[model samples]
Structures are given as C-alpha cells and as structure tokens.
Target chain A: MMKQSNLLAIVTCALGLAALSPSAMAEQLLEQQCASCHALQAEDYASSTVQERAERKAPPLYYAGNKFRPEWLVQWLQKPERIRPAGYFPAAHTVPGPDGDVVDSDSLPEHISLSAADAELASAALMKLTPYTDKLDAVDYEVGNISWRMGNLNFGKFNGCDACHRDAPDYGGLSGPELYSAWDRLQPKFIASFITDPVAWDPHTLMPANDLNQAAVQKLSDYLKVNGEDE
Target chain B: MRYALVTLAVSALTAVSAHSWAADAEAGKQLYQIYCTQCHGINGDGKGINIPDMSVLPRDHTDTSEMSARSDEELIKAIKHGGKAVNKSVLMPAWDKNLSDEQVDDLVAYLRHICCDK
Candidate 1:
C-alpha cells in the first residue's frame, strides 16, 4: 500500500508538470513568432526593431484580451485572411493627386504560417492584452444625434465617401460597403487602424488614403461604431 | 389636318411612356421588405439585425439630402457590380447575380420613392 501511494503521488506530479509545460512553451513560442508584428505589451516592443517601425502593417495585439475572442484569434492566426482585403499597408500603390506628389504608404512582408502548437501559444499569450477601455468608454458618442446625422452626410458628400463606398445618397459608387451603420459591425480597434492608416492595415486596397490625423480618425471611428448597440 | 392627328398620337404615346416611368412605390415597399429588409431594415433606417455583423452599414433611404447627391448611374453600378468595383467595402455583395436588371431598376425606383418621396 505504501509503494502504490508513492507511485500515485509521482504520477499526479508528472501530470501537473506536463500540463504546465505546454502553456509555458506556448508563451515562449508566441513571444518568438508574434513579437515581430504585434506588441504583446506596450513595453515589449518599446525600443525593439518592430517598435521603430511603429507604423506597421498590422495593429498591435496588446489589447487582444479586450478586443477579440480567443477562439477567433486562434482561427485567424492559423488561416490569416486579408481582413482589410485591400492589404495591410493602407496606402500602397496609390496615385498622387493633381499636385504630382506621391503619397507615403506602408509595406508588409510576406506572412509565414505557424504550427498548431505555436498558434495555441500565441493565442494564449495574446489574450493577455488589455488597454484604453476607460478612454474608449469616456469618449463614447451618441449615434442618433444631429451631429451624427451631419457626419454621415459629410462622409457621403464633402468627403466623397460615396464616390467609392456604397453608403448613402440613395445611389453612389459600389467600391465599398454602404456606411449606413459601419459602427456596429467592425471591431473598434480594426476601425481605428483603418481610419489611422489604411495602407498599414491593408497593402492591396484600392481606397485612396485620406490625410486624416489620429484625433480625426478616432472621431470618425467613434461615429461609425456608436450606432445600433442592440443590433 | 393629318399632321395634327399624327402629332396628337405621338403626344399620347409620350404620355404613356411617362406614366410607365413612374415606378410603383407600393410594389417597391413590398420588395424592399422581402429582399432588402434583411440588411437595410423595415423602414430604410439601416437598423437591421445583420447591420452589426456587416463591415459596411446599409444606406438609410430616408436621408433625402444624401440620396439626392448620388446620381442614378452610380447607384446602378453598385447594384450590378460589387462594392470592390467602386473602391468600397467588399461586404456589399453584388445583386446582379441574384436580381434581374429589371428588378434592380425597380429597386432603384423604390429607393427614390421611399427616400425622396418622389
């Protein structure tokens, strides 16, 4: 009975260690694989080569915990789609205006696939992200106000958003989805990235890059996203 | 006297053609409910259930000022070709494959009637 008890204790210890090893290994692999494109924490890439290229083709993953589902993240990394369709670098291959000056655009290198184990680790590590939720909540705007109505009109008219996207004016060009309620559909982070730098998030998109600064981008993203909370 | 009669006949034909051009808003309202209400909402308010899931928001047909700005041609292009053709979100799938050209025309007419009260 004493010998059997010792064997049981060893087996339990071994099982616990084995379970811990994969999670640890996953964290290490995530640090190796994704640290190049995503900032695991704000400081992880603060002075690294990736940080130097702050205007990367992809958004940082530091807020993944707040922004995404673990299952979605896992699936996304395994089979990365062109989420922006246009390409990660929002302004790649765009033509200059009548002024004859070329615009700046970001370029993304080819993506490499990760093994299933590596993907699991990366997802686990990425889920640790959380940022700016307080600020996001503080700045939330009303969607049904007159200002929002005006913004929607401005987007279609002054900005010529309808020139390419298929939003309002009853009829317009069909290059983009109608913006009648984009705010409710897209992830806030993704919207912010697109608003901040289209080319950085997508490399092959045909949408012309607007010269919107960060503040304006956030405002636009907020306007688009604040509508139809229940829907 | 014969020329006057011919002119009157042409005038009658023109009137008929004009009347035909006037779309049936009632029919459009029904069609919108059946086909477009999924994304565009029951009252063209753009609050449909799928609106949240879609990357692009459906247009609110009630906004006359915005609708007035777009030409009929532009609207037709979007419906026939997907959003990508116009540098927009690819989420708005092309209805050309599913809806006939006549149906698209009717939809446009319906949009004008609902949005512009035309």
Candidate 2:
C-alpha cells in the first residue's frame, strides 16, 4: 500500500512540473530576448502621440494572437523578414534623393531571427496574447471572393488603398506594409477591424480611417484575401 | 479730432474683417504633416517617399501656377470629398470623415501659404 501511495505521489509531481515548465520556460525566453524592444504588454494606444509611435522600437505583440495566425507567427519568428519595408514609420527612414525622398532600407534594423525550437515556444506564448480580445470579437468574417477586375477597381480607383499598401509583390505603393501575403500572415477579423478603423488599433497610424461601413470593410478584406492567394 | 476718429474706426473695421477672412495656416501645416505628407511629400513637391512605387504622381503644392489656377472652392471640394469628386484620380481619399469643415479650411489656407506666399 505504501509503495502504491509513493508511486501516485511521483506521478502527480511529474504532471505538475510538466504543466508549469512550458509557460515558465516561454516566459523566460520572451523576457530574455523580446523584452528589450518589443512591447509585450497592452499599451494605451489612444493616448500615444504620433511622435511617440514613431519612436517605437518594434511593433507591439500584446495583440499577437488577435493579429497573426499561429503557423505564420511560428514561421516568421524562425525566418525573420522585413514586413514593413520602410520600417514602422516610413518618414523616419527616408533620406534625400535626386527625384525625391527615398526610403533608407539600410537604416532599418534586421529582425532578430530565432531558432526553430525557440520560435515554436515563442509563438505558442505569443498566440495566447489576446489583449484586444474585444476588438477581435467585434469583427465577424466569412471567406468570400472578390473578382480580380472588381477588386482592382475597388482597391485602386475607389478606396485608393493602393496609394500606400502593396496589393501584390512589386505592385502598388511603398509607404505601407506589403499585403501580398496578408491572408497567409494575418487573421481575417483583425484585417477587417484594422481596415474599418485603423485609429482604434494604432492611434497615430499613418493609414487614414476612411470610415468605410461594415460591408465595405468586408469587401476590402475580401479583396486582400483574394490578392494574397494569387501570390 | 472727429475726422481722425472716423478714419481710426474705418481702419479697425477693415482689420477685423481681414482677420476673420484669414484661416489658420499654422494649424493646417500640422494637419498636412500628419495626413497629406505620405503621398504629397514633406515639402508638397509631389515626389514623396512613396513616389517610387506610385502609378500616379501626387500634386505638387509648391507649383504656384498650378495651385493658383485652382479656386478655393475646387480645392476644398477635392480635400473634403475624395479626388473623384473633382474629376481627378481617386488616389486622394476623402477627409470629410476624419477632418471637420473648419479644419479643411485651415488646410486650404496652409496650401495657399506653401504655394503662393513665397
């Protein structure tokens, strides 16, 4: 009876340790590497001024779960790339050129790449971060198709989003982030929310709040989804 | 003394009317830096940082002749309503949702300062 009781005690202890290890280890990894630059906490975006936003070292990951798909986040952390070609704020990264101001890509820092194991752990932790849960819940998205011609007209001619964001690789404007892989990278609800009200996510975001209605925002999000799949 | 007082009153009235007519260019400048500079360029020269990838060039606010040709009403329409409203490229988004009517007037005043005031 005593032997059986000791065996049960050991099993309970092992299970307890197993449950604690992943979260504890993930926290250690995040604190050691990501704490210096990335904002892991929910920030008061409404109170942050333009100048303050411009000076942010890295994009906030407090809403990572809401913003990024788990697979994409894991992959991205493993093989880091420049998502915002001109850095977070294009204005701060520009220099004089013959024709006009040019984006100084060299001035931007390379995103620190993580090993596969570390990336998996980091993404697991990041995927649990849903500080903007209410914002995410507010947007409801269904997979829909936008025809190439109609999508082009809406994105370029009507809404003028192509003026800043890239709809495809080497296509559209350069000021905003490339949207060619948006479907693969971002959550649909997050995309819709951002398009509908950019200021709510980032108060000083250069992307103008065009005040598009729910249907309009969905249409635009559909346009992006179809565009992303093309590449 | 009566004649001097009449002249003084007339001068004061003229100053007040002129002041009321003028919009706040300084406030407009701040708004421009936030909303317009991404495509319009920092100096309003049409060659913004995004110019490399843009299909259509932005309007150069420094072009005095081009700006002078456009009336305040047309300019205001273009700013408040999108560029499509003025029969131009739709690349310019409408600011009606974001900016107030008074703010639009201030932006026009700032545009005038940049182009015509030298």
Candidate 3:
C-alpha cells in the first residue's frame, strides 16, 4: 500500500513537470527569438533620434499587452504578415535614388512565426506583459457608431491621416501601418487616445498630434472598426 | 507682311502649349485638394487642422519669399522623393511610388502658380 501511494505521488509530480507552464515557454521564446530583434523592455524609440530608431528591426513589444488583443497576437504569431509596408521612419532607413527621390526599396523583414501551441503560450505570456495595466484599466471603452461618409471625409480631407496610414493594403499612405485590421489587432481605446495627443503616448513619434476633439477621436475609432468589418 | 504672319503663328502655338499647361495645373490642383490641402491648408497657407499640435510647422506654401527661391527641379524632386532624399525633414514621405512623373510635374506647376506666379 505504501509503495503504490509513493508511485502515484511520483506520477503526479512527473505530469506537473512535463506540463511546462505557458509563462515559462513565453519567457523562453521571447528571450530566444524576440529579444534578439525587439526591445521588449522599452517603448522609448520615441525618445531616440530619428536615425537611431529607424535602424530597428522591429517595433518595441513592451506595450504590446496594452496595444494588442490576445487573439490577434496569437493568430499573427502563427501566420505573420507585413504590417508596416514602410519601415519605421522610412526616410531615415532607405537609400535614396540619384534623382534625390526615395523609392520604397527598404522594408522590414518577415515576422517570426510559431507553432499553434507555441503561439498560444507566447500570446498568453505577452498579454501578461502589462506595464501600463493601471493606466489602461482606467480607460472607459465602449462600442459605438459614427457616420460613414463623415469618417471617410475626416480621414482623407480633415485629418489627412490617410496621407501616412492605409485603410487597407494597396490603399492610402505607404508610411504607416494598415488600419483595416486595426480594430482586430488593436484596442480601440488606445487608438482614439493615441491620436488625440500622440506625444502623450510616444513623444518622438512622427505622427503629428492631430487637432481632434474627443468626439472626433471616438468617431475615428468607430470608423476604423466599421471599416475593418467591411473587409 | 511675312514677319507679321510668322508672329501670329508663333503666338497661336504658344497659346496651344499654354492651354495644355493650364489643364495640367488644373489636374494638379484637384490632386492637391485631395492629398495636400489638409496639411498645406486650403489656401496653401500651411495652417491645416494639425497646425496647432505640430512642433515644426509645415512650410507655408503661399510664402512667395521661400517658394520663389526654389527651382522647379528642386520642388519636383522634393514632392516625388520626400524631404529626407534632399536632406530635409523625414516627416515628408516619398510619393513617387504612388504618383506618376506627369502627376508630380503637374503638382510642381500648381505650386508655381500658387506660390511663385506674380
């Protein structure tokens, strides 16, 4: 009876050991693959010089927990796609042509991919990396609606956000990331607040702090969500 | 009489070219309203919606004193290539990948009409 009980205890311990926690796997994967290219600890690229930040291989993932949805992060890790067609500050990174024009020659390398299980682990791990948890928690997020025609007009005409950002692939500006999937990939609260005062989020970010009231910012967020739905 | 006829012919030819040039500028004006007016301002005054928030103010396109100093070649290159191509601000993204050569030239013409024309 004593031997059987000991054997059962050992089996339970072994099973627990074999099940490597998602946090452990995440830390390992992040250190092994992501940390090599990404500044996982900091979002101070905004403070760095233009030339300094432009050389980065990837955007900082320190704020990923606050910026991205867990589902989107998991799917993206499994099947990575190009987000920023132009690198961060494309002007500083790409070599210019003899005609003194910048061609879209330089772009970011392909994002790293992970297996389904690994992606899930990484996603869980990343979702827990919330340095801004207190601040983010304070935000009051609500699903809302905005006028479709007015939203389009604001993006292209009033705000000129489309000048640098794309609504979808093959449309809008080439500089910023595509916003068609923004609703899925990003938190709406982050989007509206970031644009309201960009410097509040990223001091050296090239995106001009747009002169938009609170209502406009919310409407813009709603527009992005609606636009993503259509696609 | 032959000299008078030659003068008339030259004037007509010049008028035809000028008319074509006007159409190009007109097309450029439409493009500007669509793409640039928001940043450069409706009257090309560089006081768009983002003006208050910008640290470095956008170039006032209507500033004849500055625009007159730059040649057409320089202006066209800046428009098509971006600011960093000419060692200017990196805030200006290149447009050549999206715009054709003719469209760039037209934008340059429109800039001239707005900023440099007496």
Candidate 4:
C-alpha cells in the first residue's frame, strides 16, 4: 500500500513536469535560434544612428506578444515571407537608379522558416512575452467599418502614413512595412495603441506620434483593419 | 571718420550673416532627414519614396527657380501650418506640434541652402 501511494505521487509529479516542458523547451529553442539576430529581451535599440539601424538583422521580438497575433505568428514562422521588401534597413539594400534610390531585391535574404511543430511552440512562447502589460490593457478599440474614401483620406492625406507604409500591393511608400496584412497580422488593440503613441513603444522608431485624439486613432485603426480586405 | 563707420557697418553685417549661417542651414539638414526625408527624398529633389502614391508631388528643394520665387515667410508658414494653410495640397501635414518656430526658420534656411546655394 505504501509503495503504491509513492508510485502514484511520483507519476503525478512527472505528469506536471511534462506539462511545463513545452513552454520551457520553446523558450530554450528561441534562445538558441532567435537570440543571435532577434532581441528576446526588451533591449532598446539605439537606432538614432543610421549605422545602428542598419546593423539590426531582424525586428525585435520582445514585443511580439504586444504586437503580433498568435495565429499569424504561427503561420508566418512556418512559411516565412519578406514583410519589408528592401529588408530591415532600406539604405543598405538600395542602389542609385535613374528615378531615385531603388531597393535591390536581390540583396534581400529569405527569412528562415520553421517546422510546423516548432512554429506552434515558438508562437505560443512569443504570445506569452507581454512586457507592456499596461499599454496592452489600455487599448480601447472602437470597432467598426471605415469607408475606403474616408480611410484613404485619413491615412494618406491627413496622417501621412502612406509616406512610409504600403496600403496595397506595389502601392504607397517603401520606407515602412506593407500594411496590407495589418489586420490579419496584428491585434486591433495593438494597432490602435501603436498609432496613438509610437514613441511609447519604441523611442527611436522612425514612425511619428501624430498626437491624434482617441477618435482619430480608432478611425485609423479601423482603416488599417479593413485596408486590404477587398483586394 | 567715414572709413571707421564703413568698417563698423561691414563688421555688423558679417556678424548677422555668420550667425544665420551657423544656426540655421546645418541644423535644418539634420531635421529634414528626421522629419521630411520620407516624403521629401534623401537628396531633397522631391522624388521621395511616397511620390508614386501622392496626388501632388512634394516640392523639390533643389529647384532653384521655384524655391527662389517663394519668400522665407511663405516657406515658414507652409512648414508650420501644412499645405492647406497656403492653398496647396492637403497631403503636406502641419509640423506645428512637432517643430518649434526656431526649427522652422532653420528648415527654411536649409531649403534656401539646397535650392539657391548652388
């Protein structure tokens, strides 16, 4: 009877340990694979200098939980694609052309793809890394459909986001990431929070904090959410 | 006595020019990169990355004839109050919140340097 109880206790402890291992293993995998290029810790990149910005291999993943949707992250990890066509730093990858500085697509490298199982683990771990708990909590998304005309006017004309970001394929600016997949890739709250105050998220980020009111922020968020849905 | 007066006038003029040169154009170049390059091109030739999408092209700072036509006050107003303030394209955003009066002056000086200094 004593032996049986001891065995049962050991089995229970083993099962608990097994349950915790997935997350622990995922973290270990990230440290080994991602830490070399991607910043896992919330280390601020002093990207004030052009050289420092150029040195960045990948976008910092410490804010992944705050930024990316879990489903998107999982899928993207398994089938990685170039979000920034010119790579992280456009200057390094661009060549002087007749028109202006044109991005050299040949210079860009393919992002590393992960296995299905690894992507699941990695994404799960990434989703748990919410350092900006307060910022995330404060996101009040005013959910609704924004008309194309109104959205375009606001994003392009008023806010000048089209100055850096693309709203559709081969359209808009090349300085920032293509926003066509913003709704699918990012959380609505994250999008709103980011637009409301870009400097709060990253001090040296190239994005300007337009000091927009809550209504304006919500409208912009909605615009981004529905940007490429029709296309 | 006349020679002394001429020398004093020249010295005063030199001081003013020197101050303007030192404080404005150089500072403006740095600020332009931070705030304007996305839509104003790295070379300030008006062919920014966003040019393809924009209905109205950003003004070429390197256009000597066009830039020389506009007064410093007009340029300052446009920079501070956006294009709509000057009856220009509304695409140009107002930099009133982002830039100070002094900074706008510096940007105008830099615009002059790029457009007219050739």
Candidate 5:
C-alpha cells in the first residue's frame, strides 16, 4: 500500500512538471528574446505603452495567437519576407503616428535571428495570442457572376492593380509580388496591415503610400480577401 | 387630327428611349458596386485597400481635371485592354474577356453618373 502511494505521488509530480514545461520554456523565450519586439500577454500588453511604441516598427505579438496559422507562422519566422515592398515608413524622417503610420521607429533594434528551438518555442507562445474577437470568413469571391466579373475587371483595368504585381497583363513591374493568389494565401490581419500602412510591411517599396480612409480600407480588404478564391 | 396623332407617336418614342436609358443606368450602378467599389470606392474617391500599396495612386474618378482629359473611348480602351495599352501600369488587367460590350457601355454610363454628377 505504501509503495503504491509513493508511485501515485511520483506520477503526480511528473505530470505537474510536464504541465509546467511549456509555460516555463515560453517564459524564458519571452524574457530573453521576444519581449524586445512583442507583448506576450494581454495584461502586460494592455499596460505597456513602450511595447506599443515598439510595435510601430514591427507587428504586435499580442494578437499573434489568433492571427497566424501555426505552420505558416513557423515558416515565416524562419525567413521573413518583405510583405510590404515599400519601406515600413512612408517618409524616412517622420515618426509615424499609430492611426495610419506603418513605420517602426529607427531606434528599435534590427530583427534578431533565432535558433530552431527558440523559433519553435516563440511560435508556440505567439500562437497562444488572441487579441481580437472577430475572425474573417474565407469565402470564394470568384464564384458569383457579379463579384467574379467585377473582381476580374478591377484586377485588370479600372484600378491598374497589375502594375507592380506580376500576374497582370504586361507583367510590367517588379515592385510587388504577383498577386495572382495572394488572397488565398495570406491572413486577413496581415492583409489589413497593408491596408492600414503599406510601408509597415516594406519600408523600401517603390509603391506610393495610399491614404485609405477606414471604410474604404475595409471594403477593399473584403474585396481582396475574396479575389483569389481557393487557389 | 393628324398633327395630334404625330405628337402622340413622338411622345411614345421619347418615353421608350428614356426608359431604356434608365434601365442601362441602373445596370451600370450594380456593375460599378460589384467591381469598381474596391479601388474607385463607392464615391469614386480613389481610396481603395490596394491603393496604398500601389506604385501610382489610383485615379480619382471624381477629379474633373483628370476625367476631362480622358475621352470616353480612352476610358473604354483602358477598361478593356488595361492601363498598359495607354502607357500606364499593367496592374490594371484587361477586362475584354470578362465584360460584354453592352455591359461595358452600362459601366461607362455608371461612371459618368458617379464621376460627372450627371
């Protein structure tokens, strides 16, 4: 009976330690690396003005949990892309205000590279973030006659969207990636980030900085999100 | 009696023409909302989501100076063949395959209504 009791205690202790493992590793990564660029928790993130300012340069991690697909996040952290071809700032000299500013402050440190283990831990912790209540529904915009034809026309002539993106008619410019299927590929918030501030994704893009009023941004995002349906 | 009959006939023709034009205009509005609203915006203000990331800002459909410079044929060609046909960005795809000639006409009429205050 005593042996069995000891065995139960050992199993309880092992289980408890195992449960603590993820949090402990996540805590270390947050303190050692991620805290410099992101806010890991909701309470601290809400209270943190410094972190908010830092976020002006990089995407905020508080919502990372809700925003990213785990597989995609892991891949992206391994090799970051210039999602915004334009530099993160519309202008180099000005410190961007939060409303439409996409630029991160120059004072913030450059992106730090991570080891494989660190990347996995950071991604795991980051994916635990859920900052926003709303989630975008992925519906195929190309299915209906009105949306499909209209979306096609808008992609072609009325807007001149094909200029920088390669998939358009002449495939003339290289300023932006071929957006032939960006809608099916990218996350909604990531797309929203571009709408909010083109420079935030890329500070050096040749693309002009558009001043999109809020409502227009939402509509455009809605349209783009559905543009490249399943593929 | 003959004069009265002629007047009635002319009036009926005019009414029929007006009704047709109205139908075209209505169709145009629906088309505009479905496609043009994204970049040109609901009000044709040149503020769309992709607008910010573009190398050249979208044309403000409401700008009289810009619109006045463009002929209806030019607009049609631009819409059909894309901006590159006119030495502009190829970012605008050619909609020849997507919109029928009649639909294009309807869209043009809609553009006139929204941008020219007609």
Candidate 6:
C-alpha cells in the first residue's frame, strides 16, 4: 500500500513541474528576453499615446500567433529585418524633400535576433498567442483568387491604395508599410480586421477608415496574396 | 496727450487681434511637415512617397493654374472636411478633428501662398 502511494505521489509531482512543458519554457524565455520590447500578454492591440508609439523600441507581437505565418516568424526571428521602412507614425517619420517625396528616411533600431534553437522555442511560444482567435471566429471570410489586372484596377483606380503602397518593391509609393509581401507577412484575419476598421487596431494610424465590409477587405487580401506570390 | 495715447492703444489692440486672425504660413509649414508631407509631398507637388500606393494622386499644390482657380473657402473646406467633402478621394482624412480652425486656415494660407505665389 505504501509503495503504491509513493508511486502516485511521484506521478503527481512530475506532472506539477511547470518546466516540463515546452510552452512553459517558452513563456519563461519570453519573459527573459522578449518581455522588454514585445507586449507578451498584450490584450490591448493599441499600445498607447503617439509619442509612446513613436518611441516604441519594437512592434507588439501579442497576436504573432495569428498575425504571422509560423514559417515566416521562425525565419524572421532567426534573421531580423526592418519591415516598417518609414517607422510607425506618418507624423513622426515623414520629412519633406525638395520634390514630392520623403527626403529623410528616419533611423529605426535594429531588431535583436535569436539563435536557431531560441527562435524555434520562441516561435512555438508566440504561436500559442491567439488573442484574436475568439474575435476572428465571428469574422467569416472566403479568400478568392483575385486577378492581377482586376486587383491593380481596384487598388489603383478605385480604392486608391496604390497612393501609399505598391504591388511590387520598385513600383509603389512610400509612407505606409510595403504591401507586396503583406499577404505573406500579415495574417488573413489581421488584414481583414485592419482594413475593415483601422481605428479599431490603431487609432493614430494615418490610414483612413474606408468603411469596407468583410468581403471587400478579403478581396484586397486576396489581391495582396496574388501580388505577393509573383515577386 | 491722453487722447493720442488712447488712439495708439486702440490701434495696437486692433493690430494684435488682426495678427492673431491672420494665417501664419510658417506655422502652417511646420504642421505640413508633420502631417501633409507623408502623402502630399514636401513642396506641395502631390508626389509624396506613397504616391504609387495611392489610386488617386494628391492635388499638386505647385500647380498654380489649377490651385489659382480654387477660392480660399474651397481650399479651407477641403482641408477641414477631407477630400470626400469636396467629392474627391476618401484618402484625405478630415483635419477638423486633428487641427484647430485657426490652424486649418493657416494651412489654407500656406497652400495659397505656395501654389499661387499670392
């Protein structure tokens, strides 16, 4: 009877060990390194004031699990790259040239990279962050194959998005983040939410709320997907 | 002497109010650097960095012929209410919420001065 009791105690103790779980370990490491920059437990997507956001050392990754593809996240974690060329705010970053373009490209702090193993662990932990999962359940969308011609027409001629973004690296305008790789970079649901109501995510964002429905936002996402795949 | 002093004070008070009401192109230029240059370009030429990203181009402020045709009231309306108010693009966000009435007029003054050399 004592032997059986001892065995049961050992089993219970083993299960109680928090470090035994990969997720727990990931959480530990995230607290160690990433907590300084990323809002690890950020339920609030809108971080704070304009000055606070402008001086932010890094972008929030609270929705990384839903915002980015695992493959991209893992790769990106290993090899950090600058995504927002013009920083976060149009007010803070934009500087006029003698002509009709931005003369001054604001300096952005480099993203601290992680080792392959650390990246894997961090990616796994980040993947578990699904703050929008419940909200996304209500946002039903059907991603279609948007044609390039039609997509270009809609983006450039109709919606006028091409004014701030481009379909290709060398083609589009500056100011907003580049869009050619948006489909791959951003999660489908995030793209939909942002386009549907920009103020919902970032109130200070220069992007005007166009009042697009779910369908229109999906179509735009689809167009980005098509364009993103080409080059 | 007291009459002269009163006259001077009245004139000085009127001047101060008039100065406050008059648009400050310098202040407008600073605001433009912070807000408008991202989409409207530095020189008001409508060819800002996000030009390719936009479906419709921003109005070129350097286009004297085109801008000259527009009255100060029309420009002020567009600045305060956004392009959609003037049946233009929706991309231009309403500055009514962001800028003060005086600031909007200053921007109008700046635009007028820059585009038309008025």
Evaluated with TM-score, which candidate comes out highest? 2
Ranking by lDDT: 2, 4, 6, 3, 5, 1
Segments in model 1 whose C-alpha atoms lie over 4 Å from true places: A1-23, A43-57, A69-71, A84-108, A113-121, A141-154, A158-231, B1-118
- Candidate 5 or 4, higher DockQ: 4
lDDT of 5 by residue, B7-59 (tens): 99999999999898778778887665444543454456665434545566567
Give the per-residue Cα lDDT of candidate 6 at B23.
Answer: 44
TM-scores, each model vs. reference: 0.36, 0.79, 0.60, 0.75, 0.38, 0.69
Of candidate 2 chain A, the 10-residue stretch with the lowest lDDT total is A45-54
On the 0 to 100 scale, the lDDT of residue B84 in model 4 is 76
Query: For each candidate, what is the lDDT?
Result: 0.55, 0.82, 0.69, 0.80, 0.56, 0.72
Worst 10 residues of 1 chain B by lDDT: B46-55
What is the C-alpha local distance difference test score of candidate 1?
0.55
Q: List model 3 lDDT by residue over B1-118, tens digit each.
A: 9999999999999999999889988978866654454346556776543343333456778899999888888888777777656766544545664456887888888988899776
- Residues A1-231, candidate 1, lDDT per residue (tens digit)? 579989999999998767777667677776777777766655433243221332454555666665555765666677764333223332232223332212222433545676666667777876665564544354333333225666555555445455444343244433244454354344566566655445433232233355556656655665565432312
Model 1 residue B74 CA deviation (Å) reads 33
Across A1-231, the per-residue lDDT of candidate 6 in tens digits comes to 579989999989887884367777788889988988766765343454333444455566777777788878788888976566666555455555554566356454567889998899998998888877765565676667888988877776667676666577776656667888787777777777677666555444556555556667777877888888876
Descending-TM-score candidate ranking: 2, 4, 6, 3, 5, 1
Candidate 5 lDDT over A1-231, as tens digits, reads 579989999999998877877768787777787776554544443353222331344445676765566766666667665443323322221232332223244532446667677778888887666555343333222222225556555544545545445343234233344454455445666565554554333232233334445554555556565555523
CAPRI-style class, candidate 4: incorrect
- Evaluated with lDDT, which candidate comes out highest? 2
What lDDT tens digits, residue by residue, belong to model 3 across residues A1-231?
579989999999999867867677678888887887777786555365333444566776777788898999989999998777555544433333332223254444667799998898888877777776655565555668767787777666556567667886766655567788998998877786676666555544555553456777777888898888877
Better model by DockQ, 3 or 5?
5
Worst 10 residues of 2 chain B by lDDT: B17-26
Q: Each model's DockQ?
A: 0.01, 0.36, 0.02, 0.23, 0.05, 0.31
